[model samples]
Target: MRRSIVAAVVGVTALALTGCAGGGDGSGGGAVEKATIAIAADPGSLNPITNATQAGQEVSAYLYETLMSFAHGKDAEGLLAESWTESTTEVSFVLKEGIVCTDGSELTASDVKASFDYAADPETASPYSGVYFPAEGLTVEADDASRTVTFTSAQPQSFLLSNIGQMPVVCAAGIEDPASLDSTPVGTGIYTLEDSSPGQTYTLALRDDYTWGPGDVTSDTEGLPKTVELEVVDTEPTRANMLLSSEINVAEVGGTDRDRLESGDLFTIDVPARPGLMFFNQSEGRPTNDLLVREGIAGGIDRDEVASVSTGGRGELMTSLVSSFTAVCVGADATTSLIGFDADAAAASLDEAGWTVGADGVREKDGAKLELTFVYPSTEAQSVVAGIELIQQQLGEIGVEVTPAPSSSYTDVIFQGGDWDLIWAPISTTLPSTWAGILSGPFPPDGGNWTYNTNQEFFDLTAEAQQLAGEDSCDAWTAAQASAIGNLEVMPFAESTSTLYGAGVEFEVTTNGLLIPTSLRG
Candidate 1:
């Protein structure tokens, strides 16, 4: 679930990364002839539901197949179901027949039951079980001939295909034996788990005769990569350095090191990151709680320039929470669609709010200067430095003096209780319709809700959107995004992108939003 992988603080700096010429143990082509991919963050847990990080979900996708997979923008295809008929309140999925698990038994209705049963089982400790098997009556019943799985939600769920699409089917084989699951995962996907060393690395071997994964999944029919290896390397520079040195092929490069790699011929840049941010301290009674201040801050920072500099010039401005291509983002009117850099309007808004520039050049109101210490993590993208610099300049024009307080322990400092004016942090990797599913849905009540939406309207509408599904639900998602932006509770920047460089010229690599290591070749 992209939900739990909250966007960690992105550090902005001006250091160059190691080019492809450095950081390798040159054992030669005959020594290590496999594609090795390194990642900066630890892939939290092997258990899909519990582990929310991309690294974890990336590998889990290899062993688990949801009922339906997505192509560019539509439901592509997947195991368990070929097509689906969706209504406001209910969704019926027609399962694909003849798909066999690696254990050699064909998948059936009972296996679906066991899959959810294991996840819902408290012993499995699957954090994601609630997303799929949450309701009391939510059930997956298999029909004898067509193998249709029928689901009944007490209320209408606008995005059933999307909701169920997130569920990863587990084979009965893994369910029966818990001990073997850790060593050898048995699933109906195209690859089986080969070996994994905790806190170090994991490798997957492809199934030449296997089928039943998303048809649009990266591999080609004629030939596929023989094996996949994932090396656990969390340091930001180390990831970029490894990629440059040809020690690893792919990496989630930090924003700061982007220039170093882009200057060379070895790497390619992906999408610029779109992060959700808390604009002001509602807890403070000063101007930050004021909507005008929040809007000024949002208007103050130039998103395009940040993308260009921090990403080695590979990025696009973000207007909606879910990008325009996603099902949920199309109808959103709450967010800013026309994103750009504007310092004049930002300062004017602050001026209109009664803040005057003092001799020291900082804005002041009732003897207090408009100064804030923004907190960000040190390992965040180099974009952070550019963004912060732009923000300081823009806010200075508005009479607000912004300071940067860098820390690696951003989670504890920011979330625990800190006296900071603004914080740019991400709420989730997966942009779900309801953020509450990730940290705390914005709609749910505070006491009952674990993650607070901070903005009341967004929190309420997220619930409304969840129950609405389809065209109407899609529209609601748009509205919810609007509420988030219009209220200036959080300003979203850009969509996140990754560049995967390989150390060995052995295999072809592709990703369907999930990291499947089985695609690396000899």
Candidate 2:
């Protein structure tokens, strides 16, 4: 999800180095005394339940603990819950012993139940509730004596284990006063919010008793920084400058600045992402509703050129809508055969669809010109604007007049107003099954079928996939992706690889461009 950036702050100078210190619990030795990282924006909300931005989610990953987590790759490993079992319509998790919240309260099954219940409540209105608690019957029951939490769904859900496991859990305090959680977040994780200056800076201190991290991550983990600081530096150039000057240890840098950073002594990590997709408004009364027009728009743009310009030739041309990092179904194998860059074919398709080139070089049919409004969010990341401009130029070649619309409030404009011919937003998820929610339903909030587009075959395949668990459902999911691609319902271009440059620290990025806190080392 896109994060909110309030105001850009001036860059900081390097601080004097301090001696390495042990963890809060005196566990590991030879850890970083202190460290600072630059984030592109303010998280807006510290609350994990309602915080949908990538920045918020990244920060919250440290403050909140999930039942299970993605361990380096797609494998789901235990975090709060040590072991879990799943049936067709229900999943049960056994909580680890001796887990405690930051407030000195024991972490129990009741806390887990309360967290999920709050998110599922309609009054709470969490954006992630539908995704995390997707079961139709949707019931969360906790056995305090057994220290187990079980979720029961009315209908069969193949992705139940993953969906429930990935959700961030909150303490009873956060569940009771959800409103106050916007600024003061409380959870059981590796770090606790120490101090904050809203849009300028925020700090987190390591938790002494945090031993329930996913995989082998724990408070005693070697090379874990004692204190972490997040400074808001919205501009990419400034972030790159800070990293080069040793003012900040790590920051995500892109475009031309990335070349300069890579040449320096900085260590870089690249995580794959779906750079952008052209979402056509398939609702009635829109010109792009026609299949030929959608196909023409898809075939006109060269994915390679766009990827090159967007990432300064560092990104890969997308073969499918789903990222390769996704565990389920590596990628839709039929993507190459489904979509390609063929300007001649695009023009021919438009001509066949009754749109002919007029005297002014724009196509027109029935006194209407083939003009499209391409919308994208305005951010410091240069690729977003550059990619949209390339798309405009590419579509113009096929007799389509493209107008670029850069909006600060992209979600409001696209989801609420429904105001554009094409939107350049990519949906990134760890699991391919997440697409089931994104591709389903009537429209937004409920599901991401914002275009009001529908395919009976695709829906049927996805439904079938949901009936089975794990790799057993891979075939159906692959078929669903193929059906969507063949129909040109969603046109994905450029597989974005985010590169983060660090001065003295080394870290790995998750698929969604989030740094794994436990992986950071001095």
Candidate 3:
């Protein structure tokens, strides 16, 4: 619910994505022909907190390990944290002991403490650490010989286990210079960052000593590749060319180009989960304050059309504010089902509120045009274009004028005080508990969501949910879920599905889900 706009989760360099006209023939995966994979986009700063950019998250996944990981089960091929234990209230982790950084330091409890502390500290300015570590006792007291960090939170949070699974734990010592850690990842995963020439490419070397990997890596020993590399192939056409010419081993191809990648002999199309959505401003005094109007907008958009503009031509329409993984979303489809692709119903509801379409073809009443200038962060060209266009089409049908305002460097602008109507941006969150820490906590007048869409009722519910320490607190959390979605303040969209293109090769490769590169073999 933070106002930080994102045009789309589009890549920067070689990982150009465009949906193909049809589904892939499904024959491109096998035998791991190449270890090096190229993607598009120059990853911003390597710092996990500073690197809010898409590439930063991608590389961060490669170089860091967390107490737990989100990419597990069928989706996550496996990475750090072998398994975990959950009580009604707290989930404890038995670390993936013996994992070490390139600096040769064995992964330990103290390192976990340092990494967790680094994220929570306001000084580090991590855009998202608050979501995972919500408790006070983040200290790591380890058994000198055991090499395991027993991670315990203040309460029993069902989503806490998932949150830690994706967080990248860093070595406080190795990162004496944060810039170095950012430029190169010295992780316990299969691959370590070797070199990065911004705007062109990035390269990685397979860590032969990598002992720990995702659970399903299925290695006899510490199986790995001779080397691994990532390229930042900037444009879509350029990335497709690289794939066809075998200039790169794997890449991401979406939209129309998706057809070419699926049709080409060079690469196999990998579909990770791609979630699309529109985020409403939570600032006070906005029309979003009107629950009916909010519901009307939520019910207005045609998710099928929105999905059509996205990468795979197929996207799961979200009815809840949270993704399908969260508990609140599990049993609460009742609230969500009320709002989905019903422009006729939306129009009727708006008419009840005296909002009539004006001569300009925009809705209006009380002298205000239904025209709302929709804003989104100009992070990437493809994302900006797709997000704005789809939103425009969806809202335009309801006599809503959505003007696309694009800005390449608008991180501050998006979060800053604005006169915006609606914006599309997702704050990266690993757990639902983060709802309290990021959304309600910072998005109002006093916090980061300076959009003025404050709702005290929503904030109090979030606070109440945070204090309860275990799964027993599900009742409170479920309430928060209903309040968030039912209130229609921030509309839920999609979980960004990232993709990976690869040649006939053997390794656990994917776009957005989970990664276990170290366990992969050439």
lDDT of 1: 0.56
lDDT of 1 by residue, 259-292 (tens): 5676444433232243534445555464777777
Worst 10 residues of 3 by lDDT: 1-10
Candidate 1 to truth, TM: 0.67
Name the candidate, 1 or 3, with the larger TM-score value. Answer: 3
Off by over 4 Å in 2: 1-30, 73-75, 122-125, 215-222, 344-369, 415-418, 445-448, 508-513
**Using TM-score as the measure, which candidate wins?**
2
Sort all candidates by lDDT, best to worst. Answer: 2, 1, 3
TM-score of every model versus the real structure? 0.67, 0.85, 0.74
- Residue-level lDDT of model 3, residues 479-514, one tens digit each, is 775666666656655444444555443234332333
Candidate 2, run of 10 with poorest lDDT: 1-10
What lDDT does the true structure give each of the candidates?
0.56, 0.73, 0.55
Clash count, predicted structure 3: 58
